[model samples]
Target: MSAPRMITVWGRANSVNVMKVLWLLDELAIPFERIEAGGEFGRTRDPDYAAMNPNATVPTLVMPHGYTLWESHAILRYLCRTQPGGNAFYPEAPEARADVERWMDWTLASLNDPMRIIFWALVRTPEAERDMAAVAKARDAAARLWSIVDAQLEGRPYLAGECSIADMAMGGFLHRWFSLPVERPELPNLAAWYARLKTRLPYATRVAVPLS
Candidate 1:
């Protein structure tokens, strides 16, 4: 492994995507400096920031050797691949690693579809202008997705086994799912898995904060 290098993360603290990376960094005990951008901070639109990350998305990572990466999940993989103790979290065995990747991919490809809509409606949309009907439909869809996860957790402690990056990716969003005002179905297994995730100090301190 090359010498350890300082990393810089650009994003607002409250962003779920940003929080996911932060939680991973903390879990790995990697030292990093964070700059608040995006959302109300508004630095993401700056020309220099745009040049670094064309998407202008929160959680852009600037690594040693001038390597820049965007997309929260990609950042997670980069850190895991390069850092010591990565195999435990990311795994070197192809099958073991794929087990982790599937959940991380599902977090974006499947879960985010409904979860994002509901999160925005309930958390961002003002009560007076909010469309409760739309929120309800989105919430129901998200619940169905969570049920699938709940079933997966029935026989395992973590999604990909032993609390890998898969847990962090899904746990980041799970915070929103559990915190929302909408009623949740009785997903005992999912609840237990979440409880296990919460026991991590890094997750509790960084990712479990109040939602915006």
Candidate 2:
């Protein structure tokens, strides 16, 4: 058998994107070395770092044999495809996998915009400097989107009916949503699904932390 590959992840712990990869890595039982490199850590702009990821984004993956990859969702998909137990988390069936991909795409295409507004306002921006009006509007928008997810979870435990990449993608943002101080409309199903995810050690320790 070939020697196990060494995987190194570059990004700060508090980043939602990085947390997605970390949570999935833990679930896959993959060992990796993580280097702090974004937010206050601030090495993403360095020439060497930029060479690996021109976008200067966090959560860049440095694989064995010098392969490099960036973009959080892309990294999540790549790792799932190459590592053992990949199919368990990222099914191979066209329809089943598409179900997972749709949610993951929804997170990026739909949910993230409003969610980021709320996250930045409440978590990143100081109270004295917050734009409360903007925050409120964004919160409302995000809540509506989450309600759709709540309805999706009405009779299922995971986003795609079975634990898969969809859950990993959304769980990172879900952790932020429930943790934020803003009032949320009743989303019991979403709350319960989050509660179930909390039972997982990775979600408990990594994803479900104080907002940055």
Candidate 3:
């Protein structure tokens, strides 16, 4: 198969899910166009976007040959595996690839699942519109989730042992956790891991945007 030439991403800039896909493109040095559609944009509900993705979510990818795809993490893995030298992130061996792929799956299935509420409540919600009680509850839940990932990071450089798509994908949410004004415990390991990620060019320029 030949290398994909043109790819397009659809989603808002601030969406963490969308941010992950965008960051992946940056990592692969893949050039693409992005059109804002979800959140305040309202195009997600339109028939055109819905036809592309029935779920009507952000970070949908339009492949070179017009194959449309959705789900943020899926898009990242596809780009990593399909693009030239996909092995760097996805790897060539099953154990190594699965090591990275499992965490990418975990991010969508586990880590990111709990973080949605806290992110929306803290960053997206307006001051007057905010619910302190719910935000606090979500914050506590999110902290526990971070602890799980932190535990996984005991001595490893990143999830699944390398800076794969999992790192870039989960890094989007982790960036929010560190940057937001919410109070959190002194998770030294997680903090250390984050310090290393923040130094990356993509994390510094894209994933490391202002929290609110």
Candidate 4:
């Protein structure tokens, strides 16, 4: 009998998208190898890398059978659908799954832009070169978006009413938002949800990390 082929993930550790995949993998106890690519590691633009991921993005997944997948949220869904115990995270019920998926979509569609702006301005840009005005504007936008999340999480411990990929999708960004040196509106539910996520070991080790 042949040994099972291990899954390979390509991306730098600090990337929020990559962190989401890693956190899920750890939660599922799935073994995989990670290769450094993108950011300072710099293979994203290589022809071979582009062949694997034309978007030149990080968190590309090479499956055990040699198939490749990209897009972090899509990858999260694929992993949960295929791996053992994945159904617990993704759910088999249509309505339940949709609840999980909508937040994933919202994270990419509504929350990502302002979060990216805030993250880049505050973390990546040097203080002398920092755009405080842009940071403040993005911060306000992000706070409003998080307010939506806060409302959604009002009676639930996690998005979709249980721990699911929706939380994983937004977890890293939540950590970054709280960690950033910007003024933020008081969001109790969001803060409580974040505290709940922190107790999960995978979230603490993988999603919550010092921003680069």
Q: Candidates' TM-scores?
A: 0.95, 0.96, 0.91, 0.96
lDDT: worst 10-residue window of model 4 = 1-10
- lDDT, candidate 3, 1-212, per-residue tens: 22246798889888888888887787778789888888888788788888888997897899889888898877877887788755677777878887787777877777765577778777778879988887788788888888888898998988878788878778988888887778998788899888998887877777888864
Q: Per-residue lDDT for 100-159 in model 2, tens only?
A: 999999999999998899899888988899999999999999999999999999999999
Off by over 4 Å in 2: 1-5
lDDT of 1 at 27: 85
Each prediction's whole-model lDDT (CA): 0.87, 0.90, 0.81, 0.92
Clashes of 4: 0
Cα RMSD, each candidate? 2.8, 2.7, 3.0, 2.3
Which residue pairs clash within candidate 4? Answer: none
lDDT string for model 1 (1-212, tens) is 12126789999998889888998899888889898999889998898889889998998998877788899999999899898776678988999999999999999999987888888888898889888888889899999999999999988999976888898888878988999888999999999887888889989988888888
Candidate 1: worst 10 consecutive residues by lDDT? 1-10
lDDT of 4: 0.92
Best by lDDT: 4
Query: What TM-score does structure 4 among the candidates reach?
Result: 0.96
